[model samples]
Target chain A: MGEHETPADEPPTDEARAEAPVQHGCPVTDSRGQTVLHPTREQYVDVVKALADEGYGMCVDLVGVDYLLHPNRPVADGVTPERFEVVVNLLDIYNRRRIRLRVQVPEHDAVLPTLFDVHPGTEAMEREVFDMFGLSFDAHPDLTRILMPEDWDGHPLRKDYEVGAIPVQFKGAPS
Target chain B: MTVSDPLVRPGYVATGEGGQEMRPRSEVTSAELLREVGAVLRLSEADAAALADSDPDVVGEIDPDLDDQTMIINMGPQHPSTHGVLRLMLELQGETVLRCKPIIGYLHTGMEKTGETLTYMQGGTNVTRMDYASPLNNELVFSMATEKLLGIDGDIPERAQWMRMLLSEMNRMSSHLLFMATNGMDLGAVSMMIYGWREREEVLRFFQKVTGLRMNHNFVRPGGLAADLPPGWRDDVLRILEMLPPRLEEYDTLMTGQPIWRERLQGVGVITPAEALALGATGPILRSTGVEWDLRRGEPYLHYEDVEFDIVVGSYGDAFDRYAIRLAEIRESMRIVHQILDKMPSGDYRIQDKKITPPPRARIDESMEALIHHFKIFTEGFKVPEGEVYVAIESPRGEIGCYLASDGSAVPYRMHIRAPSFVNVQCLPHMMRGGLVADAVAVISSIDPVLGEVDR
Candidate 1:
């Protein structure tokens, strides 16, 4: 969405919307002077592996973001915005450079290939995204919850998940 | 949940659904071990294949003659040495740990979900509690992210930047002090605990005088600080700085040079640089592996570029190296603090922007407009430009980061903190492997994980 896109403003025309995003070989954008690459779910691991070979050895962080409310959020040309995004930050210590990869995962099919093969450090973080967002990884060994109980009903960090909808339960309280 | 259910097993969860289980070494085929163990250990295919070939004690298939000597044991959810409610399930063969898994979330309270409800102006209070030991760093990272989004990151006054750096370095010293106490206590140096707390308390006293709270001082805010430094804050800081060198020397005498301390930690819980990087361990754990990576030096944020300091590293990535690195870092932090004192600039502590900064108390009392502005700023809060940014800084633990997305509203669209301990805790299993069960406490203490940050 545009920075000044108020609810009162007229909806963007198809022609204007088409021309907004600049074309790139692989839809790249910048946020606050940092490089951001928008990769599809399929290209996620390959991009990370290639980056790893190029000295981005450490996978600093991997997080899941739900874009349910901001469905119309902006993206680079040739990139489609999905309901969910897996944001991975990779660091090249030798070169002192950092690159961010944003992989779009559709809500209907929210599975992405695990990055465990490339970066084993992402084990807990991948489990965390799975626990919080209900997004599964294709072959994540131990894809269970990391920060939630085994019997958790739904992903808590989802936009639609109500915060206090369920009654609080004590271990030995009267039902 | 009934007792008869197979899912319920005292403290152990059955393997298959991402749970870790240790099978007999004889039963684990080379291919199976390469696929399973190799992944967990981040071992290369060549290395895994080599490991499989080297173990020629028995056939690849399960040997009926070989007994399954390994038994799984739970270390903590309540063990005093865990630092907090961290639970570790260790698969032990005799006393050697074959496989280990860390089960966390005993302290989870969904603080990220809570961050969405609070406006950006009030978000500092929520993040400060994540790493309670280094609350200023938490607040500093969050504020930096928010300021980046607000596009006033460059406009921050020189004095404010210096002040933030001062508080951050001081927080590092205090957190390391706390670690010294816990590491000593965990290793049976009970007297070191008293000495550690004694020194840390003095640092906390300085924090209390400046921020009005010992731990979670939401004092560092988005625009600048919540308030300026209290009068005579320099004298208070100097007193603590002067008092620390001698105490640190006393610690060196008591623990660093002691044969018992060296024997307990020297070769215990060793991790190579490859493993540390692959496992995502940072801060002292990464540095202890002899990898020269420090955010302040490698990627300078705030006025770290202007300051002079050395990145301390270790030759052998052992528990002793970790302890020694942190001990040396305390002295380095003091050096930085002294430099900050010398170069502390004079200017407004916060930005003078009317949109973000609240009016002064005297102005609010005398003018109706000022009062109304204050009310609006506090109640409604200012809208941030629609964008997303991730800001990371070197906390005492590792890289504490804040990822914020705004939809041009007072309340953030999404807020996430990439906590260091959360990632660093993953190293436990790899580090504990092949070590004696007794050394487990040493490994845990060396990590010095603050559960509040780990589970947050």
Candidate 2:
């Protein structure tokens, strides 16, 4: 009888059902009360476009983070956080709500589809991520070095990159 | 006195021992001279190739059809009109700009990478240097983000909130005033520069009185300010408020109606609302495009919701609209400052949580525990729970957000600044694409990008 009981027959509880973890293309709120969506690298563009359709028009910021050292960074259960993550912040101007999309990219193939087609503002930002973290954006029009020199030796912002400094010389100091 | 001596003038020759040969220097083209110099310097083809590869002036591919007529010109990493060390590559066809690409990183100090090394407590010092024009705004955004990451957003004192509002508003005024000065100079209104700087100096004097620095006031810290406002702070604020309104009117008289000012800005560098939104433009730039989206009004942080001020909007999204929006925003900021002075709270300037902030100097002298707590707070700095948060404030240039990710350590795992100038400068090409080359200066000045923030 318990198993066959209609769902409406059950008494309503005071507590709302905790939102189920979104495994596919739905948005979930993070612990910090931010609406974070974990979209697969394949669904990145579609998810972003869906959110954009829901009035999240502006792509406020786009940045890449190298979690090489901080592999233990928390994510919802059953979701595997990858070595490189591209975080995109979207703003719903009319509603004044913010949505962050975190897409995990594998180390071997650190390539993600470009959001430039959906959000033209991501052109420079995508270039910046490519320049800093050695991540690549497929179908990006001008995927060239932005901040670093064109022939710069390596991606300087990666966690594993060496921190090198050149000693400053004074006018009268020995060479 | 040899007859065929190459040293002799070309027209005359020395035939005998007694005769003098005079040779005019061969008409050397500049290109020939350069070739000879290159040959003398032993510049090989490999060296030439290397130079071309490393040359900062190397322009990207231009349209093949117009390449013959379009000449690429470099405008700064040094020019005064650029406002900072911003370099622009302008492909010009006769006086019209075919395309303009803003090349940054001349002033890049890698502040985001540097932020990873500093503790949460020391984060303000690094961020404040990024947007040096609006230093306090950087401090405010960084502090707020750090506080949010620490989950102590509600723990900030009421007095600190109002103080933050007051000082940040004043910083906005100072930053706008600087734009006014530079904009005027860039557009050839040199006298406006003098007037603008004079007014800005007064504001800086007030900043010095409160924060102990004319620029880079890293006084705003996580959990609250470095210290409470000094005595007579209200009186000083009142004087500034009183002094500014009439000066604003004087600017109206000087430039608002001036034909040259109007001509240079009114219809130049027009950006549509769709373009502004798609480009993620915020602050005055977006507002100038008739979008009433201000973080203060839209997503109120601190006590901005409690304050009474109108979100200034512009009708036409042009250079003039941007200028008008900034001018009106200064007045609105003053109004907010006045409101703050009236409703200023009397309480702890910073949170009293000893774990986050150091103990008062007076308390340290009385209690050994206080001294130890102070030492630990400064040297070790309190750790934040592992999480990430992005907090943005309506900075003078635009939305300055700090995206901070914590790994349960005193130092942030990753700190990415969504610097408004960095994002806003991307729109320059959009604005300057088809405009006359002369209007490029007007457009760049109107955008008012701070290169420090852009490059960082």
Candidate 3:
């Protein structure tokens, strides 16, 4: 089956309707016919939960991107772009449909509620975002570093962070 | 007689408060060592009392509920069975594991951060190193994502698509062969190691002939392949396909029907479907749960829909089920490869679009505009339009996805590798919980996580 399957038969939840300002309850198409949802940070978990109930049970991937340098990033009409964006890809296995959710978290207050309670598989992914982008997840069980050392000084993935270089050493070549 | 014995000299030895021997230093290389030892020995009564009274902070806070009798053991940042530098801290109650925590980052190279500095053309080189075992999958996902962002996906030539599927299936075979070798070694079937590598060497020789490297082949690129397949590539693939079936049957005789192998793997490391979904396990781990979700068949990218093969599934999610699925998948991959060889298309290996790929070498020498286009494409890479895309493929490990965001620049704004091994490793704790410590190696090998991807 192709990705252009009919939407789930379940009625839209009230929480999903409330997210109309950020994203219409109807799914929007991207290049590949993936339904892209731009939910506000407040409605992030609610939208994910609502979709999970509708058989988009598998969380394919959760990714965090720093749009620090990309100020002109496109967004829905009513929503403002943020410094950091968390992108989630969910799949409905039985239906063979893919959905993409993009949520914006501002620079000053870069916090989004945890999706771990809904998708327990997101535990490590959430920790990775906290490690790389310094974005916190509220009510996350353990928000420690996953990819970097625990004592690592700064978020390495931020646009402002320098990509520092360590000089290569050769024996008896130089001090 | 004991006190006066010449062998037990008085000043040569000291006894601890608990009557343990404190041997005197015999060969002091430097005065500094001698002085430190003398100072330690000559501590005055007050100084010694002060030393005894001091309490060290090294014994930090422990979980209050952790029983004092619980034995915490570290498996590896350097153990043979971990496949890499993966370290697992296990809290054990006798022989049974109570809790397991995987502490990674020992192999972290920060490839994602480094990807931002490289241009879009150079992105494949960085991602191919993430999942080194199945490098083409990484390259394919990154290239597809880049193509999607550039809106040039439709322009890719047909020959290149078939070539990609062919090479990827070969890569899948090689990766699974490595798994078979390592899994056997981990499970104490030492002879299977030799047999597995013998078969894998045949496959790698073909890879070396095609890509000029055994592993980390950055051959798959944004628009298409690095170059067209070498002469007689089809015959080479057909020969391998003809030889693999009997070798796979040899494995059946060697391990599949063996009662000991079944006893070690069956009913061990059971991950329920609910737990598997909750933990986001994919690839064989999810397939073993009877999900029937193979991205190649389900998502249908890279002309996989044109091929005919079954999505191998297992009745029970256990180590044996995972093993059976992988073995079955090798057969399925062989079937796909056979079809690809027959239906191989004859056309340009890469897209003819000047914006995405440079003009041919023959055209470059003949025409000035072609030369200039080549120079521009190589020196200043083509800029991708402002957008984001997440493209995934059924890698040997799992759904290896690449999330790329471009900002109308030659270099990507952000690149995130949704590494399958990274997510799959999280389920290790759940699998190992309450299982015997001896079975941990079996479970870890069954997951077959490549540390390059896990700690990327």
Candidate 4:
């Protein structure tokens, strides 16, 4: 995104940037006003354990997004400490409730506590995250590349990682 | 010999005359798999041309099918029930499943990691890849989470909400239609393969009418939908509505009451009500076990609070119950689609605030502010002050959720999906225990797990 980030850019009006994080949950504000959700980052396991205590039993998915063009967080964070951030979604099947737990990690030793005791299903999901993003989970049972081969290098999902050998102009892709 | 489960056949897909009979699972061997994968993974045309071998899993049990003692059989990464590229290690004795372990992540693409880098509008397009079968739910869930963080639920225009509900229900029907078609094909009702695809294509055609794309309509966004329903979109939907009922009846006659359907489905894949809750089954799989809960009714969102619809549930959580619940849900979805069309409020399709939606095509060139807002959303993107929100919807399969985190950036800080297929697949081993090997296909069909959602 550095290529697209013109030097002339201006921060949003104070009206858009002034909302602070909530005290208890650290819920953040979006572009809208007075939203109850506070956006804050925590240790990945703390977010999971907190939600489990709150009674959501399911850890459904863990997805990765490269921040090459992100305009908010420091794009270079992945290259330094707090470089990699991962989102964990938990669910309360009985109550039909849900919550998002976000955690940021520095690149050199990108590691976080595991939530395997809380949701055993996270075992495979975390491994795939490790396999894809190269983020390490401190206590994950078998944190190996779950999808890509062991020899694959660089996190394909990162903003800085070029698609490389994969032809960007492959034919027959869906429009 | 009589074979129970339906197969496309191993190197024997001629479909007519005696191509060959598929061997039962007990006769399959690991050496054969090692042999075949060893070849295909490294096979050239010389290796390919000489390949007269059938699919290894179907050729025969590479290992003994049933020992008096239970042995775990890995059904996929290649088989169908796990859906997509799932590998289910099934522990069984004779035909009864002793335990099941679902091994996943064969289709992980890490779209969540990609979402953190794209703008808000791009997130909608990125998240849609998670659940390819019913994509509107992904868009809706992501939009709702963003709206929750932005504190703009009410600001979303009435017309957009109404249109979203309509599209959601239609997406539900189309998704279930695919499930039914596949379920029927799995159970040997070949004509259902044709009929199910026909109905699904009709719905997809309607989706193309509104979103210009069929599978992943990135139309629903935080502030509102991508755009208004095209002129005559209501009529296009009505065409399918008019004909869908009779087609559903054909499916009912072909599947619901047939003796074999009952035997294959009933008493199979039994999960107790308690187990359904404990195992985290939602949507039809949980509801069929007698849990009368749906987010639309229990935790109403969008226009559900204003609409009239029943939460479909079955008394016993079995394969039959799961299958019936889907049939029932198709009816419920139809009812909601009608109410949305009849009561839709007309107004701006998206919020008037310049922060969330892109400036309309007309305003992009004329108004400077609108142009700036448009450029911001596409480039830098709008920021959610800093907060997290979880939004879930009742997709055709079950609960499809979007968990989003924002640190005042155009891209999400973190985005996680709580896909239902991934959850319901957990109960596969429990349901298959004590069931016949033939019942495995029935149970898989009833669960209707989609690998896209699971592996994502």
Give the candidate number with the greatest lDDT. 1
- Which segments of model 4 are wrong by more than 4 Å? A1-175, B1-74, B80-82, B91-94, B364-380
C-alpha lDDT (0 to 100) for residue B15 of candidate 3: 18
lDDT head-to-head 2 vs 4, winner: 2
Extract clashing residue pairs from model 1. A1-A74, A142-B18
Candidate 4: tens digits of C-alpha lDDT, residues B1-456: 236534453432332112112123443343443332231123345434433344434544333434436555667678754456866666567677644555666686656666766777788888887889889988899888888878887678888888889988998999889888888888888799899999999999999988999887898887888888789987887888898999999988998989988888888888776566545677898789787778888678888999998888888788888888888888888998888889998898888877766778998788998887777778877877665566777888777777676777677776777788877776776677556777787888888877877767
Q: Which candidate, 1 or 2, would have the higher DockQ against the true structure?
A: 1
Q: Tell me the tens digit of each residue's lDDT in model 3 across B12-31.
A: 33311111111222221223
Model 1, B189-242: lDDT tens digits are 999999999999999999999999998999999989988999999999999989
**Structural similarity to truth (TM-score) of each candidate:** 0.91, 0.86, 0.85, 0.72
Candidate 2 wrong stretches, greater than 4 Å: A1-17, A23-27, A166-175, B1-65
Looking at model 1, residue B81 earns an lDDT score of 98
lDDT of each: 0.86, 0.81, 0.80, 0.69
Stronger candidate by DockQ (1 vs 4): 1
Alpha-carbon shift of residue B358 in model 3 (angstroms)? 1.7
Ranking by DockQ: 1, 2, 3, 4
How far residue A95's Cα lies from its native spot in candidate 1, in Å, is 0.6
Each candidate's DockQ? 0.44, 0.27, 0.26, 0.14
What is candidate 2's CAPRI-style docking category based on DockQ? acceptable
lDDT of 4 at A15: 50
